[model samples]
Target: MTVCAYLALGSNMGDRAEQLRQAIHKLNRRDGIRVIRISPVYETEPVGFVDQEAFLNMVIAVESDLAPEKLLETALAVEQELGRVRTVRWGPRTIDIDLLLYGDKMLQLEHLTIPHPSMTERAFVLVPLRDVWEGGALPVLNRPVDEYLRLLPQENKGVQKWGTIGWETGFDHSES
Candidate 1:
């Protein structure tokens, strides 16, 4: 059975948009994963460690047969393949892939947490999340993604709509 999973993508190093594009392609290319709906990119100021470059962020919903852990592995693999170096938490990155939701399942493991800890507080995550979340109420939140978005003024965080990466049909492999 295929389950829908939502993942957030961000980049602030190298070709930020290109990194996001490649990550989406790689995720879709993985077995048991299909790229479904993708949200427009949002440019936001860096959170936590605030000394980095601004980030271009977006969200994507995928249909996956892989378990949550396996899905996370796939995401990590994409990040690694994209030259993501994890030297600092919330620091500048070539690419960042975060699994925000897995169907309606809730998980709290050592390394992975479903509903992604503190996602609701981050506008960079929630702005794009509102774009792709279609369910009546956000699984466990009991409110729509937009409602959560409204609660927090993403504008205060410098979150704004950026670009709509045109990759619906397929990626132009010649360019990265």
Candidate 2:
């Protein structure tokens, strides 16, 4: 079985851009997983924990044979590999990988949730996510990316496309 998964990547500690790249690389390298499309990296002001440096964030689209639970475990492993520390909620981190959507499947387990609970509310997640889906639509929300972005609170956090990372840098996600 193939699942169209959406993941949101963000980093606020160390080389933020590099951390994001590493997280994605690790995801791609996992068995039974392939990255389909990656949105351009975007820089945004920190949300919630207001006094930290801005974060470099992006969304990745992947097709995987792994089940949702296994995928969540894979994401956590990648976070650990990238030096992520969970000292505080919404705290600084070397990397953060959130499974935003799982093939239109709604999940609620002890440690994971599909169609990520807060995705619609976060501008950082929504903008880049829309970029990855070829048609710029969110399958889980059934809403256009443009519309979802507009509904976010009126904050001036800006997001812009940075570039791509090399395959050898971290994990590998093959593109078809």
Candidate 3:
């Protein structure tokens, strides 16, 4: 069976746009994954790691035969390959990939959760998510993604579309 999943991509450590593009490529190249759609990249201010640079972010839609756990593992691997180091919570990094949703599955375990815990709270996640999912409903929330976006406070700081990039694009760092 194919599982529709949403992934949020972010980078601030190096070539932000290139890191996102490379991460997308790595995701599509995974054995059981297929890229369906990708939102235009957005530039957003740093959230948690306030001392670091802002992040270039995007969201990807994918149909995957891989299970949630395997998918999470693959995302972690991509982060590692991009030179992500877990030095601090939300610290600056070369790449950061998050599994935002996995079909309608409501997962709650030690390391994973569907409809990511903080997805709705951030404009970075909500804006790109709405771009790709506009009228689509979130698996766990059972409400349209746009509705959730509407409910949030309108304080999007520096989140705007830079341009479009794809899976086939070579991973070259594009300065943000």
Candidate 4:
């Protein structure tokens, strides 16, 4: 069976935009995973650890035959391949890929959590999430993503649209 999954991608180190594009391309090349739609990239301030550079963030929708766990594994692999280092919690990194939602299934395990625990609170996640979700109710939240986005505190939700991704704007491969 195929499941629709929403993934959140971000980067703050090195070439942020290019890292995102590469990650997406890698995912698209993976078996059982097909890129469907992608949200516009957003430049956002750091969350937990505010000392790092701003992050370029976006969300993607994919149709995949892989189970949630397998999908998470693929995401982690892509992060590692992109040279992500987890030296600090929420610290700067080359790439960060999170499995935000998986076909309305609620899951909690030792290493992963569906509906990403902090998704509701972070603008970096919610802003791009709303872009692809378009006010659709999330499985875990049972409320439209935009509703959650609106509930966030204005002062701290430092999300700003950076620009369109190459795929979204039909840019040449060389430009991406």
Candidate 5:
């Protein structure tokens, strides 16, 4: 059975756009995963480890036959392939692929969490999430995601729309 899942992708190192594009294509090429839709890219200020370059962030919707844990593994594999070095908390990365939601499944595991805990708190996440999700509400949040977005303080409001990604022409990795 196929499950609909949401993934948040962000890159702060190398060619950020290309990194994100590459990650998306890699995920799309995986056997059990098919990229469904992508949110517009956003330029966001660095979060916890704030001394690094700003990040390009966005979300993607996917139809996947992989279970949630395996899906998270795939995402981590993509990050490793992209040369992501996890040295600091919320630090810079070549690419970061976070599994935001997996169908309506609520999961709590040592290495993964669904409805990614920080989704609503960060505008970088909510802005693009609102773009891809059909409605303003999310499965886990009782109130609309917009409500959380509005309450985020200005210090954390460093998110702004950048542009959309093209899936067919430039970054095609269909046969990979």
Candidate 6:
């Protein structure tokens, strides 16, 4: 069965924008996964660990036949291939791929969670997500993502559009 899923991508280490683009490219190349649309990239301040560099963030809508766990494994492998090292919680990284939603299926497993637990509270996640979000209520929130976006506190103004991904010349990843 094919399922539509939203994945949030972020990077704060070593050519952040290029890292994100490469990650997206790798995801699209994966079997049974096709990237439908990508949100405008956003630059945001680090949340949990403020001692790091700013992060480049974006969301991608994908259609995949891979099950949730398989999809998660794909994401993890992509991250590892991109040089992601998990040293700290919410720490800086070369790339971060989060499975935000998986076609209305709510799940809680040891290695994965659908609709990412902290997504609703983070503007970095919600803002870019709102960009690619099609018309429908988020499965876990049970309300439109925009509604949840509005309910969040306004203090986190860190999320702002960086630019369109493929159109931007600064994201040339071929040399790396």
What is the lDDT of every predicted structure here? 0.87, 0.81, 0.83, 0.88, 0.88, 0.87
Tens digits of per-residue lDDT for model 5, 13-108: 999999998999889899899888888899988988889999999999999999999999999999999999999999989999999999888888
Structure candidate 2, residue pairs in collision: 25-171, 26-171
Candidates in order, TM-scores: namely 0.92, 0.89, 0.89, 0.93, 0.93, 0.91
RMSD of each: 2.8, 3.2, 4.6, 3.0, 2.0, 3.6
Could you give candidate 4's per-residue lDDT for residues 1-176 as a string of tens digits?
99889999999999999999999988888888888889999998888889999999999988899999999999999999999999999999999999999988889999888878888988889888887884478876899877887898897688888997687743232322
Where model 1 places Cα greater than 4 Å from the true spot, the runs are 153-157, 169-176
Select the stronger candidate by lDDT from 2 and 3.
Answer: 3
Task: Report the candidate with higher TM-score, 5 versus 6.
Answer: 5
Put down candidate 1 lDDT per residue, 17-114, tens digits, no spaces: 99998898888778888888899999988988989889999999999999999999999998999999999989999999999999989999999999
Residue lDDT tens for model 2, 1-176? 99888889999899887887778767877897788888888788887788888888888888999999999889999999888889888889899989999887988888887878888888888878877777656775678978878877687436766666553233334553
Tens digits of per-residue lDDT for model 3, 43-66: 888876699898888898888999
In model 3, where do residues sit more than 4 Å from their true spots? Answer: 156-158, 166-176
Q: Which ten residues in a row have the lowest lDDT in candidate 6?
A: 167-176
Indicate the residue-level lDDT of 78 in model 5. Answer: 95
Residue 125 error, candidate 3, Å: 0.7
List ranges where model 5 is wrong by over 4 Å.
168-176
**Cα lDDT over the full model 3:** 0.83
Scored against the true structure, residue 18 in model 4 reaches a CA lDDT of 97
lDDT score for candidate 6 against the true structure: 0.87
